[model samples]
Target: MTTLPTTIKRLVNHGPEDYRLETAALPQPGERELLVKIGACGICASDFHCYHGAPMFWGNETFPRYVKTPVVAGHEFYGEVVAAGPGAEEHFGVAPGDRAIAEQIVPCDKCRFCRSGQYWMCEKHDIYGFQAQDADGGMADYMLFKPTSRVHKIPQSLSLEECALIEPFACSVHAVNRASIEFNDVVVLAGAGTLGLGMVQAIRLKTPKKLIVIDTMPHRLALAKQLGADEVLNALDEDVVARVKAMTEGYGCDVYIEATGNPAAVNQGLQMVRKLGRFVEFSVFSRETSVDWSIIGDRKELDIRGAHLGPGCYETVIDLFHRGLMTAEGIVTHKFSLDNWQEAFKTFGTPEAVKVLLVPEAE
Candidate 1:
C-alpha cells in the first residue's frame, strides 16, 4: 500500500470572516480502530458556530470544550474502510473495501454514563471533527474510528448522497427517543429545516394525532407538508403558539420539539406544550439565551428533555432512509462539491437551501 500524505485539508478559523482550509497532518489509527477515507461530509450549523467562536456548548469554557482554532469542522459523513487495525475488523464487521459511516462521539466505557448506556454523557467524551482526539475528521480525506465509537456499514440501495444525511437523521432519531411520542399524540415541531424535517419523519412512524411544523419561510413550510406534516404554520403570518393551541383544542400539543436553534422559538415551544407534556430541545442555540422558567417548570410541569448526538440510532436511521421511509430530497434542494464549499455555506444562509450538502470528492 502507498504511504498516505502527512497533511490533509482542514478548515481553520483565525477570526471572524477569516476561515482557512489548511493542510493538516493525517492521524494514525489505534488498536480496535479502523481508518476511513472520507467520501462526503455534511456542513452542519455547528460548523458555522465554530467558525464564529460562538457560545455553543462545544465552545463553552466552563465545560472542557473541544472546539478550538485550526481544527477540522464536520461530523456528518460517509466513507470507505481503508485500513482496519488489529481487532477492528472483527469488532466493526468491516473490511478494507466496505462503505461505512463514523459515529461522532466515543465515550469512555468506564464512565457511569456509559455503564448506564447514556454514553453521550461520558465525562471524558470527545467530539469528532471538532477536536483531534484520535482522528483527523471527515472534512479531510480520512478519519479514524475506534470499535467502541459507533460505526455502521452503508446499505447498497441508498445512494452515497442519501447516506450523507444519516448523521443528522440519527440526531432526529435521538430527539424522537427523548420525546417518546406515543401513537396519535399531537406533536408541534418548531422548524422545517434539516433537523426539523428529520423530526417530521420520525414522528410519522408513531402515527401522531397531528404533526404541526412551523417556520418563517413558506417554501420550507411547504416542504414540511410534503414530508408528512399534518399542518404547517408560517410564523411570519400567524402566532405559532396560538395556532398550535388552536390545533390541540387549547390543550396545546402533547409534545413540542424545538429544532430551530432560536432562543425565542425555545420559549415559544415551552409555551405551546400541554400540561405534563414533553418538550425536546434538539436545536443548537447560537448562544446562551434566556427563557421563561415558570412556563417551563411550574405552570406546565413540563418534562424538558435534551437530545444530542446519536448513540445507537445511526444504523436505524440509515435503514429508514434506505427503505425510502425518510427523505430530504425536498429539503436537500441544493448541492455543492468540496471545491464550492464556500458557496454551499452561503446558500445555507438563504431560505432557498433547506439542507445544503457538501459533496466532497463525490463522483
Candidate 2:
C-alpha cells in the first residue's frame, strides 16, 4: 500500500475568478468510516455557484471569512475503498480495492427526520462537498466515507468513469418518480442540457404519449430528440407556449418539467401546465425571483414540486446503467484530468458540451 500522505490534490475556490489547483491534507478516517481513493468526480453546476460565490451558500452567515479563502469543492464522485475502519468493514461488506459511490450527504441517523426516512431533511446533515470540516471531499485523492452514509457497490460490468454520472442520473430518476408520470402521459420538458436529457431518458421508460422538448439551443434540442423526445421546439425561433399548446390541442401538457434554472422558464412552466397538471422544478435557482402564484394556485391548480437531489435512487440508477437501460457515454461529452479542472468547468458552460467530467488522478 502507498503510504498515506498528509496532503491531497484539490481544486480550491477562493472567490469569483479565483479558482486554483492545490494540495490539501487527507482527512483521518473515524472509527466507523473508511478511506476512499477517488477515481472520478463529476463537476456539478452547484460547484460553479460556490466557486463564484453567486448564490451565497447555506451557511454563508456562519463562516464569513472562509468564503473569500480557498474552499475545497466537488460532490458527484466514485471511489475505491483503500482502507476501512473497524465497523465499516462489517457494514458495507467491502474492503480495499472495492469500488463504491459515496452519498453526498451523510445523514445523522439519530435525528427524527433521518429516523423517519427523510434523511435529506436531517438538520445535522454533513454534505460531502460542503459542510463537513474534517470530511474533505472528492477533489482530493482520498476522502473519508462515514459508516452511516449511503455507499453502494458499483456493478462489475460498469466502469468507474460511468459511476461518476450515476448521481445525476439518480437525480433524474427521483424527479420523474416523484412526478408520477404514467404511460402515454403527454409531457413537455424545458431545457436540453444534462438534467434535461437525462429526464428524457427516464420519461421514455414510462412510454409517454408524446414527449415535446423545448430548448433555445439547437444542439441540445437535437440531443433531446436522440434521447426519445417525440418533438423538439426551438424556444428562440418558435413561440414555445403557443407551439406546446398547439401540439397538445390547446389542453397543454399533462406534465411540465422546468429543468433550466431561468426564472422566465419557471413562469413558462406555469403557463404550459394544464389545469390540475404537475410542474416539477428539477433545477436549482440560487437567486430569489418573482412568479405568478395566483395563476398557479387558482387558475391552474398545478402540483409543483422541488427536487433537490436523489435521496435513494442511486442504486436503481446504477442498476439501470449496467443493464443498458441508461446510457452514460452519450451524456458525457467531455473528459479532463483533475489537473485540468478549469478546462472541464469551462467546457461544462459551453454550448457544445453536455456533461463534463473530471477524471481522478488514481484512474
- Identify the leading candidate in terms of TM-score: 2
Overlapping backbone residue pairs in candidate 1 total: 1
RMSD of 1: 2.4
Q: After superposition, how far is residue 313 of candidate 2 from its true place, in Å?
A: 0.6
TM-score of each: 0.91, 0.92
lDDT per prediction? 0.78, 0.79
Off by over 4 Å in 1: 1-7, 13-18, 24-28, 57-65
| Per-residue lDDT over 1-363 for candidate 1, one digit per residue giving the tens place of the 0 to 100 score | 746677666555555456667765676677888888777787788876666666563445655456644456677878888888888988988888889987777677788899998888887776776655543457667777866777789967887667888888899889988898888799989988888888889888889888899889888888889989989988879788888887778999999888887888888887889999999988887778798898877798999899988868988888898788988577666767666767777877586777777665643
Residue 334's lDDT within candidate 1 is 70
CA lDDT for candidate 2? 0.79
